[model samples]
Target: MNFFKPVAAVALGAALSASTAITAFAADTTLVISSWAPPTHGMNAKMWPKLTKMIEEATEGRVTAEIKYKLAPPPAQFDLIQDGAADLTWIFHGYNPGRFVATQLIELPGYQGSAEAASVAYWRAYEKYLKSANEHRGVKLVALHTHGPGQLHSSTKVTELDQIKGMKLRLGGGVSGAVGDALGATGIRVPAPKVYETLASNAADGVMMPMEGKKGFKLTEVAQHSYVMPGGFYRGSFALIMNQEKFESLSKADQDALMTVFGEPASRMAGQVWDEIDAIGVEATESTADNSLNTASEADRKAYDAIAAPIIEAAIKAATDKGVDAKAAVEFIASDMAAN
Candidate 1:
C-alpha cells in the first residue's frame, strides 16, 4: 500500500505540472502591431522582432506582438492604435508636422551623435520634458527614438552646396522641409515609400533621408550621389506607442515587466537597429557602380550653420508657446547623447 501511494503521488505531481503548463499557455496573448514600413526595413526586420522577443521573454509568454503590414498607412497608425484596431505601432512625428512641436526638439540639425546615442537622448528628454506637452495623448507611449542623421541624396552630383539651389528635392517633413528651403530647393512632399518612384520619374532630383535609405528605400538604385554634413541636416523623430486600453488589459505582473523592458531599453534597441542598417546601406552604396557618399565642405557647413539659426529660434519660440523649455530640452538631449 505504501509503494502504491508513492507511485500515485508521482503521477499526481506530473499531472499538476502539465496542468500548470497548459494554463500558462492559455494565458499567453498575442498583441497585433501595425507597421507601415516595408517588411524588410530595419524597424520591421530587426527592431520589432527584437522587441517582440523581449516582450515574450519578459512576460514569460504571457504577452507578445506580431507586425501586420499594410494594416494602415503611416499617418493613420496613431489613430489605429488609439482605436485599438492595432495594439501597438510606431509613428514619425515629422509626418504629422506642427501637431508635435516638442518632438521637433530632437529633429533640429547639428546634433553630434549616432542614432543610438540620439535615441537614448530622445527617450530621456521625452520623459523628462516633452511628456508634459501631452503630444501623444491617446496612446500609451512605449519609447521615443530618432533615425540617423539626414543627408542629401541626388541623381546629379552636387560638388557645391549652391549647386542644389534650383533642384527639386523630396523632403521627409519636419525640419527636412526647412532645410530644403534653406538650401533653396523646391520641395516635393511624399511618403517615404514613394521616394524611389519620385526619383525614377524625375519628379524629384534628390531626397533628404538617413543613410539607411540606400537599401531600406532602395535609393541607391535611383539616387546615386550622397552629400552629408558634419552634424546632419535633420533627424526623424519616431515613437513606439500602444493602445491605451490594450495596455491596461494586461495582467499587472505582465504590465510591470513590459514597462521595465520599454522606455530607454526599447529606445536604445531601436537606435542600434538604425545604426546597423545605416552601416549596411553604406556598404551597399559602395558596391553600386555610380553611387558615392560625399562630405560637405567646411565652407558649406558654415553656411548651413548660418541658415539654421532662424529655424532653431523659430522652433524654440513654437515650443515655448507650448510651455516646454525647448532650449533646456535641446541641451539635455545633447548632453544625454554625449554622456551615453
Candidate 2:
C-alpha cells in the first residue's frame, strides 16, 4: 500500500508539470511588428492592435504579435521584412523611390471617397491588376491601404493655389512629390516622423499629408495654417507586409486562417482607423487657437484639377510600361470607390 502511494504521487506531479507546459504552448508564437511611428500615433495605438487582435482570433490565440518600435527606419521596413529581421511591418510605397511604381496608381489625386472605400478598392485592384508586377516579391503582402485626402498644411497661411510656388514643402515622394513639383513647390524629402522637426526648424514650409497629421504628428503645434483642398491634393499609399519565411513556418491551419483575415478585410479595417484618426486631427485643428482652416476657393480648386490631370496621365503611362492595364485599373478604382 505504501509503494502504491509513492507511484500515485509521482503521477500527480507529472500531470501538473504537463499542464503547465501546455499552458505555455498555447502562446506559441509572438510575431515582432517593427513600427517606426510614435507610440501615440493612430497607426501604433489603434491600427497595429486591431491587426494583432485579428491575427490572434483567426488562429484561436495560437499566434500573437507584439509591437516593437524603432527597430529600423521608415524606408528600411520593406527590407526588414524581407530579411526576416522582423516578422511584420508597414511600409509607405513612396519612401522607397523606384522600388514600387504600380502603387502610385492609388496615390493619384481625385479619388472621391473615404480611405475605407479607396483601400477596399485598392486591395481589389492589387489582386486583379497590380499583382502581376511582382513588386513585393520577397515579402508577403498582407494588406494595402491609403490615408484620407492629402492636403496642404503650412506655417504661413496659403490662400491661393499659386501661392504654393517656390515654397519648400515636405513631400512623401511618389505622386506627392510629383504634385509638389506640379505646384512649383521646392520639394523637401522627409519621412512623416521627421515632419514636425522639419517644419519647426523652418527647413520645410509645409507638408502634404492627411488631416490625421494634426493630431498624429503634432502638426497642430507647428504647422497651424491648414489649406484644405476639396477632394484632397493626393493620397498616401501604404502596405502591410509579413516575412515570407515566418509566415510559411506557421501551421497550415493557422496560415489559412490568417489569410482569411488578410487582404481586403485588413485593408478596410486600416482605412477605417485612418478615417477615425483623421476626424480626430480635424477636431484638434479646429479646437486649437491660432490654427487657421482655409478651404480652397472654387477658382483654386479648378486650377488644381487642371494641374493634376497631366500627373494622373503620367502615372498611368508609368504603370502601363510595367505591363499593367493602368487605365482600366484606375477606372475600376474610381468606380468602385464612388459606389462604396
Candidate 3:
C-alpha cells in the first residue's frame, strides 16, 4: 500500500510540472510597465498605447506590454526598472538631479523646431555624442525624447518677462532650474504629477512646462494664463527604459525585432504624440473661458536671448565634463532641426 501511494504522488507531480511548462510556453511575455502619469495624460493615453502596439507588431504578438500607474513616484522610475519591479518605464531626466548631466544637452534653451524635429535630432546626437556618458547605465534605453518647448503657465497674469522675479514657480529641474534663476524666480522642485495640486493650493505661482500640460494635467483650469516665448524657455528631456535582464531574456529574434521599432522610431513616435497633445493643450486654452495666452514681445525675446546664452554655455560645459563635445553636439542638433 505504501509503494502504491508513493507512485501515485510521483505521477501527479510529473503531470503538474508538465502542465506548468505548457502554460508558460503558450503564454505571451507580458511586460508590466510602471507609469507615473495620470491615466488621461498623453503619455498614458496615446504614447504608451502606440508603444505597446509597436512592440506587439514588431515581435509578432509574442510579447506585449501593459501600463500600471502609480507603482512608484516619478523620480523612483529608474530605480524601479533597475530593481526589476517594472519591466519598463519613462523617466524625466531632470527629476533625479545630478544623475543626468549629458541629458541636459537636449533640455537647453533656444533649439528651434517642433518637438518631433528636436527628438529625432536628440536620438541622432545620442548616437554620436551622449552615449559615452553612460548616464543611463543600469537599464536598456529604448528611446529618448524632448517635449514641446517649455512655457510659463500661471494662475495670475504674467504679461512681461520681468514679472517673473520673486514668483515661486514649479521648475522641473535641469536647465529649467537655471532659467528660473536667470529670470529671478524662486524655484519649487516637484514631479509633473504634483504640479496641478501645487498650483491649486497656491504653493506655486506658475509652472514652466510644455503646452501639453494645459490638458494633460488639467492646467487650463487652475493656471488660467500662459506666457509663451517663441521657442520657449526650455524643453524637458525624457527617456523610455527597460529592464536590462528582462530585455536580454527575450528570444534573440524578438530582441532584434524590438530593436527595429525602438530607438529612433520610438523617439519620433513619442515626439509626434507630444505634438498632438500640445495642439490639444493650445485648443483647450483657447476655448476655455477666461484663459489667456500671451506671446513675449520682441524686446523680451532679445533680452531672453541674452539671458539664455549664458545658460546654454553652462550646459555645454556640463556636458563637456561628461566627455561629450557638447558644442559640436549642440550645433549638430540645431542643423538637424533646421533641416527638418
Candidate 4:
C-alpha cells in the first residue's frame, strides 16, 4: 500500500508540471502595434523601436511586438485600436473631443509646463484619479504623452495678439480651435497632411501646432514665420492604448513586462525626445530663406491669456456638468506644475 501511494504521488506531480508547461506555452504570444507615422517621425524613429526591442528581449522572445507603420492617419488611430484592427496604437485624445471628456483635463491651458513633466503628471492623474470611473472602459492605457509647447506658424508674421486676429489658422482639434477662437483667429480644422497645401494656396494663413510641425509637415516651406508665445497656451494629449480583449489574452508575465516599459519613465523619455526633435525642426525651419521666429511680448501674452482664461473657465463649467470635479483637477494640475 505504501509503494502504491508513493507512485501515485509521483504521477500526480508529473501531470501537474506538464499542465503548467502547456499553459505557459499557450500564453506565449505575439501582439501587433500600429502607428500613424511612417517610421520616420520622432515617436517611431526614437521611441517605438527601443520599446519593441525591450519588450521582446524582456520576454525572451516569448512575447513579440510587430509594428505596422502608417496604418492610418492620426484621426483614425483611436478607432483602429479600440476596434481591434490593431492590437495597440497611439491615440490623440483631442482628435475625438467629446469621446474622452475626462481625459481632456490634461489639455487645459497653463497646466503643463514641460512635456516631460506634463506627461508624467498626466499618467499619474489618470491612474490615481481618473481611472476609478469608467473613463477608459474598453481599452488598456499604456501611456499618456504630449508634444512640446504648441506655437503659431504662419506665412506672415504675428507679433502681437492683434496680429492673430482674423487670420485663418489651421488648428488640429477642439482645444486648439478654442485657443484660436480666444485669439480671435478663424480656426480651420484641416488634417495635418493638408496643411502645406492649404497654406500655399492661401486657404489658411497660419497653423497652431507643435514647433516640430514646421519640419514634420514641411510647413516651413510655405509658412516661414513662427510666432512663439512666452509659455504654451495649450498642449495636446495622446495615448498608447491596447484593446481590452487583446490585453486580457496576454500571459501574466508578458503583461507585467509590457507595463514595466510604460508609465512615467517612458513618458518622460518620450517627452524629452519630442522636445529635442522640436529643436531640430526649429533649426531646419530657421535654415530656410525668409523663415524667422519671434516671441510675443509680456503684454501681448497677457492679452492672449486673458482671452484664454475665460474660455478655460467655461470649459471647467462644462466639465462640471459632466460630474467631474473640474476645479479641483485644474487646481491640482496647476499646483503640480508650479511646484515641479
Candidate 5:
C-alpha cells in the first residue's frame, strides 16, 4: 500500500502537468476581424495594424488577429460578432439608430476636442456612466472612439450658416440627421460608401462627414466644397468590440495580458489615426484645384450657436430619457479634451 501511494501521487502530478499544457495550447489565439470600411480607410490601414501588433506583443505570441472585409455591412457588424460569424469588429453607433442611444452623447455638437481626446474621454465615460445602460451587452467592449468633426461636403460651396437650408444633404444618421433637421436641409439617408455616388449622380447636394471623406470616400471628386463650422456640426461615435465567448475562451494569462492593451489605450490608438487622416484629408482637398473648403464666418458661427441650441436640448432629452446624464457626459468630454 505504501508503494502504491507514491506511484499514484507521481502519476497524478504528471497528468496535472499535461492538463496545464493542453489548456495553454487550447486557447483560440487568432482573432478574425470583420471590417466594413474601405480597405484603405485608416480603421483598416492604420488602426487595425497597430492593434494587431499590440495583441501579438502583449500575448507573447499566444494570440493574433486578422482583418477580413465584407463579413457584413457597417450596421450588422455587432450582430455578426455576437452570432460568432466573426470574432471581432467595429460598429458605428449612428448606423443602428434606436439600438444605440447612449452613444449619441459623444455625437452632440460643440464638444471642443480632437478625436483622440474624445476617444479617451469616451472610454472613461463608458466605464463610469454608460456601462449602466448595457448598450453593448453581447459583445465584449474593447474601446470606444469618435471620428473628427463632421461637416458638409457639397457640390456647391456653402459658407453661411443658413446656406445649408434646402440642400439635399446625405445624412449619415445620429446627430448629423438632427443637425440637418435643425438646418431645414432635406436629409437623404445613405451609408458612407454611397455618399460619393449620391453626390456624383446629383441625387443629393452634399454629405455630412468628417474632413477625412475628402480622401477616404473620394468626396473631393464629387463634392468639391467643404463647409466647416467652428466645432463641427456633430461628431460620429464608434466602438471596437470582440465576440464575448471568443474572448472568454482565451487562457486567463493571455486574457489578462490583452486587457492591458484594451479600453482607453486602444481608443486613443484608433482616434489618433482619425486625427492624422483628417489632417491628410485637409491637405488633400486644399491641394486639389477644383476642390473648395470654406469655414463659417463669425456671424455665421453665432447664428449656428443659436441653431444648435434646440438640437442640443433634444439630444439631451433623448439621452436623459435613456437614463444617461447627458449634461455631465458632455461637460466631462470637453474637460478631458481641454486637459489633454
Candidate 6:
C-alpha cells in the first residue's frame, strides 16, 4: 500500500505539471497590436477587432491579440514596430516619405477606383513586380491597403483651380505636398493631429485628405466646403506589419494560421471597411446645411492632371534609382488598374 500511494502521487504531480505547461503556452501566444487610430475610426471600430477575432477563431484561440490604441503618433508607427515596441502596427507609407518609394505606385492619381480592387492589385503587384522583399527587411508585412479618393476641404469655397491658387493648404505628407505644389497651392506640412488647430488658427486655408477627415477631425464645423476632384487625385497606402523577431518566435502552427488569414483576404476586408467609412463621411458632411460639397470641373481636372503627370514621371525616375524596374512597374500598375 505504501508503494501504491507513492506511485499515485507521482502521477497526480505529472498531470498538474502538464496542465501548467499548457496554460503557459496559451498565455505566451497572445499577439500585441498597436495602432495610431483611436477606438472609433473604421480601422479600430470595424476592421482591427474583426481581424483579431478571425485570427483567434482560426487558431482555435491558440492565437489571440491584445490591441492597444494611440500607442504613438501615426508617423512613428512603422519605426515602433521595427524596434519591437509593438509586435504589430499599421503604417501609412506616405508618413515615412522616400522610405517606401517602390510601394508609392499605389498613391498616384487615376490608378485606382475602389479600395477592394486596389488592395488586391497592390498585393498582386508586390508579388509579381516588386520581388524586393528587401524593402521590408526586418519586418513582416501582412497587407497593403489604401484609403478612398482624397478631396479638398476648405474654409472658403473652392469650386475651381483658380480658387485654390495662393491658398495655404494643410497637406498630409510628401506626396500631398507635391500635389498641392503642382496645383499652385501653398502646401503646408502639418501632422494629422495638428490639422484642426492649424485650420482654426487661420494658418491654413484648407486640407487635402480623405472624406473620413470630416468625421475624424470635425472638419465640418471649421471647413464649409468640400471639393471632390476627378481621377482619384490623392490616396495613401497603409501597411500592416509585424516585428520580425515576434513573427519568427511564433510556432509553426500559429504562423500558418496567421498567414491563412492575413494577406489578400485581410487587405480586402480592411479596404471594404474604408469604403464603407468613406460613404459615412460623405453622408456626415452633407448632413450639415452649413457645409457645401462640390465636384471639380473637367477643365479644372485637366489642368491639375497636366501638373500631376510630371510628378508621376519624377516618381518613376526616383523608383528606378532605387533599383526598382520603374517603367515595367508603372506599366504593370496602369495595366492592372485598367483591367480591374
Give per-model TM-scores. 0.92, 0.93, 0.92, 0.86, 0.91, 0.88
- Over 50-161, each residue of candidate 5 has an lDDT whose tens digit, in order, gives 9988887898767878899988888889999999999989999888889988888888887788999989999998887788789999999999999999988998888788
**What residue runs in model 1 are displaced by over 4 Å at the alpha carbon?**
1-27
Candidate 4 regions exceeding 4 Å error are: 1-28
- Candidate 6 has which clashing residue pairs, if any? none
TM-score of 4: 0.86
Q: Write the per-residue lDDT of candidate 2 for residues 1-340, one digit (tens) a residue.
A: 4798889899999999999777645777999999999999999999999999899889988999999998999999999999999999999999999989999999999889999999999999999999999999999999999999999999999999999999999999999999999999999998999999999999999999999999999999899989999889999999999999999999999999999999999999999999999999999999999888999999998999999999999999999999999999999999999999
Residue-level lDDT of model 4, residues 245-296, one tens digit each, is 8877878887787777767766767777778778878898789888999888
Q: On a 0 to 100 scale, what is the lDDT of residue 195 in model 1?
A: 92
Model 6 scores a C-alpha lDDT of 0.80
Q: For residues 1-340, write the lDDT of model 1, one tens digit per residue.
A: 3798889999999999999888656547899999988999988999999999889889888887778988887888888899989899999987887788888889998789999999999988888888889999978999888999998999988777888898999998888898899889999988888899999999999999999999999999899999988778889999999999988888899999999888999999999999999999889889999899889899999988998888888887888899998999999999988887
| Candidate closest to the true structure, highest TM-score | 2
Please provide, for model 6 over 1-340, each residue's C-alpha lDDT reduced to its tens digit, 9 standing for 90 to 100: 3798889899999999998878645744777899776677788888888888778777777877888977888888888888999888788877777777877777777675677677777777777766563577778888888888888999898888778778899887756767888778888876777788899999999999888888877788887799998656678778889998988888888889889987888888878888888888888899988898899898988887887898888777877788878768767766766676
Clashes, model 2 = 0
**Cα RMSD to native, each candidate?**
4.9, 5.2, 8.1, 9.6, 9.3, 7.0
Q: What is the lDDT of every predicted structure here?
A: 0.89, 0.95, 0.94, 0.77, 0.89, 0.80
| Candidate 1 overall lDDT versus native | 0.89
Per-residue alpha-carbon lDDT of candidate 3 for residues 204-233, written as tens digits (9 for 90 to 100): 999999999999999988898999999889
User: On lDDT, who's better, 4 or 5?
Assistant: 5
Ranking by TM-score: 2, 3, 1, 5, 6, 4
Q: Pick the candidate with the highest lDDT.
A: 2
Error of 1 at 232 (Å): 1.0
- What is candidate 4's CA lDDT for residue 192? 71
